[model samples]
Every structure is written in C-alpha cells, then in structure tokens.
Target: MGIQHVGEIAVWASARDGNADAFAELFDLHRDRVFRHALRLVRSQHDAEDITAAAFLELWRRRDAVRVVEDSVIAWLLVTTNNVARNVSRSRSRHQALIDRLPRGMYQGEGAFDAVDAHIDAEHRETTMRGALAQLSIADQNVITLCVVEELGAAEAAAALGIPIGTVKSRLSRAKARLARLAGDARAAVSTTGGAL
Candidate 1:
C-alpha cells in the first residue's frame, strides 16, 4: 500500500483503540465535508452544524462498527450524515407542525425578526429550493444529494450507498427530471397566484 494509505490505516487503528486525539484528527479531516453535505440537505447553517456534530458523535459511538473504505472512514461518515440529516428534518417538521397549530398571537410579536430583509429573502429562496427537493422520493433525494449536490462520481455514490452504479445513474436521472418538474410547477403556481403564495 501507499504511504498515505498506511498512515490512514494507522489512524483508524488508533481511533478504534479509543485514542481521543486520533479520533479528533479524523473529525478535523472530515468535519467540513460533513457540514457541507448536511447543508445541501438541510439548507440552514445552524441545522447543518447540528447534523455534522451528530454525525461525528455517531461515528465515535459506532467506531467499532464502522466500515473503512479505501483506507478511510469518510464513506461511513457520509452515510451516517445523511441519516442524521433525515432525522433532523423529520424532527424539525414535527416541531414546526406543533408551532403552526398554536393560536396566532399566542407567542407575541417579532421575537426573531431582527434579520435584515435581504437575509430574509435569501432564506426564502433556500426554503423554496428545499421544498422542491422535498417533493422527490427519499431514494431520489439521497441519490441527488450524493451525486448532484455533493458532486460525487456515480461509482463513488454507489459505493457509499451500497448500491450498483447502474441504480445510482437511473435514480439520478429520475431525480433531475423530478426536480425540473417541481421547479416548473412552482413557477406556474407563482404566476397563477401573482406571487401571492
């Protein structure tokens, strides 16, 4: 094996043996990548940070069970990040539902409205894009997140997802088409409602 591969294996071995510094090194190496992938899924920096943290926590918790690929644990971290993001999304939706059901004016006025108008507009666009992504099946979402958003090669995505490359390609194709359709529908709706919705 190459020198880098040997070094990575040593790190993994140390991490598996409960070496905190070694694990921290691994975390430092992959945290930004995990955060970026989480952001692509959640579209909020705060939420992405939470997901990234959770993924690393999970990595430590399941260190012994991790499957190292290509002399690195990044693939496992990515898969765990995806799962964590999904859970965070579900929990956020449930919390939002509860908040929505609360009677209006019960919470008083403008608690977190200190954000600037431009920031609000950017947040709205991000929410709209996330909503469009939400319309796809979870499988399609995973495929698109890995292949399109994360820009992983089809083979890499297939390996990360534990599926055949052909499956990744087909799902990615369908996801792209679905996203396009969803975007078009959103535009039509906006035009029909004169941007009211």
Candidate 2:
C-alpha cells in the first residue's frame, strides 16, 4: 500500500535470491521493529538484541518457508520473533534464576531510576499489559500481536495466519476485550494490595 512496502518486497525478493546487499537492506529495515517487539517480550535490552538477531537468522535460514503477507515479510518476522523470544526465555530460565540471586545496585546511578509519577504510571501500565498478554491463549496472542501490535490489516493478518479475514477481526476484537479485562483485574488487585508489586 505504501512505497516503503513496495521497496521492501523488492528487497526481500532479491534477498531470497542470495543478494547480500538486499539481505542487509531487509535487516536494516526490520531490525528496530523486531528489536522493539523483543524488548516488550523479554523486558531486557540485551536479551531483546539476541532475540532480534535470532529472528533474522531464522528468516534467512527459512527463507523458502517465510510467508509474505500484504506484500511484506513483517508478519512472518514478528511471529518468528515471538517464537524465538519464548524459546530463549525458556532456555534462559535457569540462568536467570542464578542471575536474579546475584546482588544488584539499588538505583545507584543518576537517571537509572526515574522517580517521576508519570513515568511510574506508564511503566506500571506497560508491565500490566505485558502480564495480561502473556496470560492470553496463543491464538489470542497471535491475533493481538499481528493486528494490534504490528497494525496488520485484517486481511493481511488473516493471510499471515491462514484464516479468514472475518475470523482475524473477530479474534482480534475478542482478544482485545480479554486483554482489557485482564488489565482491569490486575489494576484492581494491585489497588487492593495498596499498590504493592
């Protein structure tokens, strides 16, 4: 629909044909989005970088299997990122358990921890949303991620997911409602606990 997407499609085709420059172009175009999505899932900058790299590696490794939805590879990349993040999270669980046991400084550096009320509120909302999204069924999470997080069109999301457009739209709607309910319940529970995490 946009010129960038047209360029992206051409670049992807070239990359699939073993063009190094085109592959780099694809990586440059998508790295930030993939990284941001990873950051949301993992909540760690370094882990997000690893997840983003792994997703792109999978893209090249599985190029023939990658699907282009709505003249773009973003849906495939993002879904792959999600899967990669999950796997990484699972594998890192033991390592993270040890890491958590290690002592860390308490907001020692300036700007390390923002004490602003607005910042805290935004952080809380983000945390609650991440928690709620994690609680959703995989199907619901897929629809929500494709349709809402990545802003894929219903038709595009349907194609990416191999479902009808109507199904994608309906599932997105229901998933959004469920997510909102979960967030509300979380808020209520936190408030009842005197805002304790």
Candidate 3:
C-alpha cells in the first residue's frame, strides 16, 4: 500500500494496539500541514513546533476516538491542531506578554523612514498587529484569524471555532470593527506626521 493507505491503516491499528510506530507513521504523514496550521494561529515558530508535537501526542493519546477515511489524515490533523493551538494559546504566558509588548509606534507605521528601515518597520508592525489581535476576545479573534488570516472563509471558520455560521458572522463583524479602530489610530498618527512634514 502507498503512504495514504499506510496512514489510514496505521491510525486504525494504533487505535487498538497503542503501537508507537504506527503513531509515528501518522505523525510523519501530517506533521508539516499541522505545524503550518498551528504556526498561523500561534504566530511564533517555536510555539508552532511545540503545538505540532503536542497535537500529535494528543492524537496518539486518544487514538480510539479517531476515525479515518482514505487519505483524510489532513482533516484529522487540522482538528487536532486546532485544539492543541487553542490550548497552547491559553497556556502560554509569553503569548500574553507579546500582546503587552506591542509598541504604540509600530501600529502607526512609524518605525523607520528608509528602504531598509521600512522593512524593519514592517516586521515590527506585524509584531504589533499580532499583539493587538491577541488582545481581542478569543471568540472575536478566532473568527478573524480563521477567516481573514488563515483564509478559511465563513463556513470553515465556523466549523473550526465550533460555532454557528451566524455566530461566526457576528464575531467577525466585531473583530473587524476593533481591528479598524486600531488601524485608524495608526493612520491618524501617520497623517499627523505627514502634516508636520
């Protein structure tokens, strides 16, 4: 059998025998996608790696509850990764600290004035943006993160966040408003600088 067949069989067998090799094969099959998904949510490479490891470990822990259809390991990984990512978010003090560290200037797009400066400025702005995003309510943030950042769209975001489509829409609206207010303040600051110039 190909890797696809191997994955399904391994998951099925691992579910019964607690076979570490079977679990390892499953991890090999899905780790990259899972890591990328976690990275998108966690926004730190190190955290993403940890989340990926933890997710696979958790999958192995609950192997019996896992069901598989042919080559559908990615779906299973996505679900597990989502759960692990949320837990990682809840547990990480450094994640909260990053939010607190969002510099006021970065949001205003005011870090530097030259080409190299602009590149550095963009990095800081991203950091600040992620930090600000982390400050929103988890429900609101998850909506925007899944729909906008992850490009998951309305229905997919709802599934990932485990809410009704209407709830997803409601939360997304609130998140956008909060994000706009944040961006607006940044723009006003930029304009004030322009006026001074």
Best by lDDT: 2
- Per-model tally of clashing residue pairs: 0, 0, 0
Model 1 alpha-carbon drift over 4 Å, by segment: 1-6, 110-118, 121-125, 194-197
Give the worst 10-residue stretch by lDDT in candidate 2.
106-115
Against the correct fold, how does model 3 do in TM-score? Answer: 0.55
Residue range 1-197, candidate 2, lDDT tens digits: 33375678888888898887788888888899999998887756888999999999999999988999877898998988878877786787887677667677532543443444335445777878877887787778888889899888898888898889989888898999999999899988888976633
Worst 10 residues of 3 by lDDT: 108-117
State the lDDT of candidate 1 residue by residue for 1-197, as single tens digits: 32245577788788889998888888878899999878877857898999999999998999888877667787778778878888887898898799789987877543554343236445545655676887777788778877787677898878777789999999999899989888777767766876422
Residue 88 in model 3: shift from native, Å?
Answer: 5.5
What order do you get sorting by TM-score, best first? 1, 2, 3
Candidates by lDDT, descending order: 2, 1, 3
**Best candidate according to TM-score:** 1
Query: Comparing 2 and 3 by TM-score, which wins?
Result: 2
- The global C-alpha lDDT for each of the candidates, from Candidate 1 onward, is 0.78, 0.82, 0.65
Worst 10 residues of 1 by lDDT: 109-118
For every model shown, what is its TM-score relative to the native structure?
A: 0.80, 0.79, 0.55
